[model samples]
Target: MRLGLHALGIGTGAEPAVIRAVAGAAERSGFATLWAGEHVVMVDESDSPYPYSDDGTIAVPADADWIDPMIGLAFAASATSRIGLATGVLLLPEHNPVIVAKQAGSLDKLSGGRFSIGIGIGWSREEFEALGIPFERRAARTADYVAAMRTIWRDDIASYTGEFTTFASIRVHPKPQQRRIPVLCGGNSDAALRRVAQWGDGWYGFNLRDVDDVAAKVATLRGLCEQVGRDPAELRLSVALREPRAPEAGRLAELGIDELVLVASPPQDPVAAAQWVTDLATDWQ
Candidate 1:
């Protein structure tokens, strides 16, 4: 099974020196990917319930610093040769699809086709309000945005007509080095499962409790794929463990997990943390 470390571009290691050091360490340690998650802004007090947690509150403090995921991945790209870079889950409907296509394409090209985007319809209504974007029908918006972005990447001169995006034939230069940059859909809802079967190249299920949880989700996803006439084996399946459960690695692999992501905290000693992770990976392998 492939191992991915989550937390390259957030919290303490978000700085240039730490980012470079950690990214290099991770790559040298044989990590398959480095994932960066994003939240453009957070409201101090909001009614939004954090879906990943049992409690209806977010783990991140409202005051936490959130660097842009693309910029963070760019930093990681410049530091590594073979390691993949990905957004854990960018809030898709908040930004313009055309701009996202350019950014994603540029990053993929510059990184030698090592970039993937994991996206979701955001949960924070207040955050959307702050950005002056409508929160309703966000799932539909995400679908349209992804479709539009794919068109931009695939065509020399692109044109797409979608509910949220519409453009005439126009040139968008510096297409991605990869024929298609992988789009990993993120979430655990039924809608999310359908989204994966319909449009996503992969499914990213985060904050899973254990191997059993992963198994259940995978089964659900398989059923959804069958309903849509999609081969479940054709899509990559990745999961982030909610808690450290090193012994479950083999079981996860048995269940067909492509990558296992571990949620990391801001380390006081980034080098030591990297070494610790490397040791854990070695043990798992």
Candidate 2:
């Protein structure tokens, strides 16, 4: 499996110049991809249980400088040519699908087709409330949004009518360089696996604790693919490790992880963090 850097430290490491330095260094050092995630707004308190940690705590503080993943990726794309840019997982249900389709297509165009989308139905009820999106029925809404975006991406004069979003015949220009932007569904629940089997290009597992966790998930995914009549080999299986390094990275690869992304930071210092990640990335690749 290849190594990718999920820029989790950006909450603190986020100077414009610093991002450029780190992204440039990542490309120069041969890391395969650089990923960012999205959180447009945050509240001081939420009943939401964070799933990616041992104890369910949202890692980033309420006042963190979490930039829009797309914009950060745009900045990263400008700084580096070869490394892939992704939203590790964008909150798809909280925004307008048509506008997002346009933005993602534009980003792919700008990046020379190096953009991939990771998405989820999400767990934060308060976040859904803040966006005025209903927390219940999110799964159905997610499906509709994905279908609408696909229609926008795949059609010349696109029109889609769905329960959540509808549009008349309109031509959206500058289609993505790739035929379809890869959609990796995040979350490991049965519903998530079904979504991946039915509509996604891959599965994106987050904060997977170990190789055993990954293996069991992959096995379940394979069975889901069978039930859906989709070939398992056609899917991209990637995982995000919240820890800075996974000693079992190769072991996970052996169990069928195509890409393994590790959380990293120069959390306290940009230049120093940049150089630190730069040095580690050299050996990682």
Candidate 3:
């Protein structure tokens, strides 16, 4: 299994030198990708329940910088040559699909096709309200937005008709250097698994703390793929390490996972962060 860093801390107000050091170290150490996560806004606490943590509320600092995922990954891309850059999961329902497709395609073109997109229908009602998007329809909207983006990427003259947005034949220039920019969908629910089978290039299971569930989810995804007539092996499987579950790497690989994306703590100094990553990888990878 390939190893990757789930996050780089430039957005935590870390200095540029630290960002470069972390990205450089990870790349030089043969890590496959550097991923950035997205969130447009956050509050002190909420009843909405942070699905990733043991406690419901997300533990992000009140002052934490929720930088734009693509821009952050673009910076990481500039710092390295070959390491893939990806969004661990960008909140797809919040943004305009045309604009996202342009940005992602531009980054992929600029990075020599080293960009991949991992996406999710966001869970925060407040964030949705803040953006004036209805939270309930986000999943359906996300499906539409992804379809639209794929159309933009795949065609020279792309036209789209969808529930939220539509346009006549128009081309978005500087298409991704790759024939298609890979999009990995994140979530473990039935709807999300179906979305991966239907719309995504891969499955990125979010907040997957239980190792047993990993095999179960993979089984479900493979069964769904067979039902859809898609070869299951063609789909990549990756998981974000929510906390410090250090011993499951081999088990996950045995279950047919393609990648393990480890999360790094937010620290202003890059040297420690780099070393911690190296230590974890040395023991696991």
TM-scores of all predicted structures: 0.97, 0.94, 0.93
Ranking by lDDT: 1, 2, 3
Model 3 lDDT per residue over 1-285, tens place: 888887564354245666677777788788888888888878666557666666777767757766688877777778889998988889999999999999999999988999999999987888898899899989899999988998999999999999988978998988999958888998888888999998789988876767887888999998899889998788888887556365887888898899888776545677776776677668665
lDDT of 1 by residue, 1-285 (tens): 898988766677576767877788788888889999999989889899988888878888887777899999998899888999999999999999999999999999999999999999999999999999999999999999999999999999899998888998988868999958999999988889899999999988989877888899889889998998999999988899888577888899898899998777646476766666677568657
Clashing pairs in 1: none
lDDT-better candidate, 1 vs 3? 1
Candidate 1 weakest lDDT stretch, 10 residues: 265-274
Model 3 misplaced regions, further than 4 Å: 9-14, 243-247
lDDT of each: 0.88, 0.82, 0.82
Q: How well does candidate 2 score on lDDT at residue 178?
A: 84
Candidate 2's C-alpha runs over 4 A off are 242-247, 267-269, 283-285
Pairs that clash in candidate 2? none
Query: Under the 3 Å rule for N, CA and C atoms, how many clashes does model 2 have?
Result: 0
Best by lDDT: 1
Q: What is candidate 3's TM-score against the reference? A: 0.93
* Candidate 2, 1-285: lDDT as tens digits: 887788742565466777887788778777788888877768898888876777777878889888888888988899888998888789899889998888899999999999999998888888998888898999898889989988889999999999999998988877888858998899977788889988899888888776787888888989989998989889988887645355687787787889888676554566776787777876665
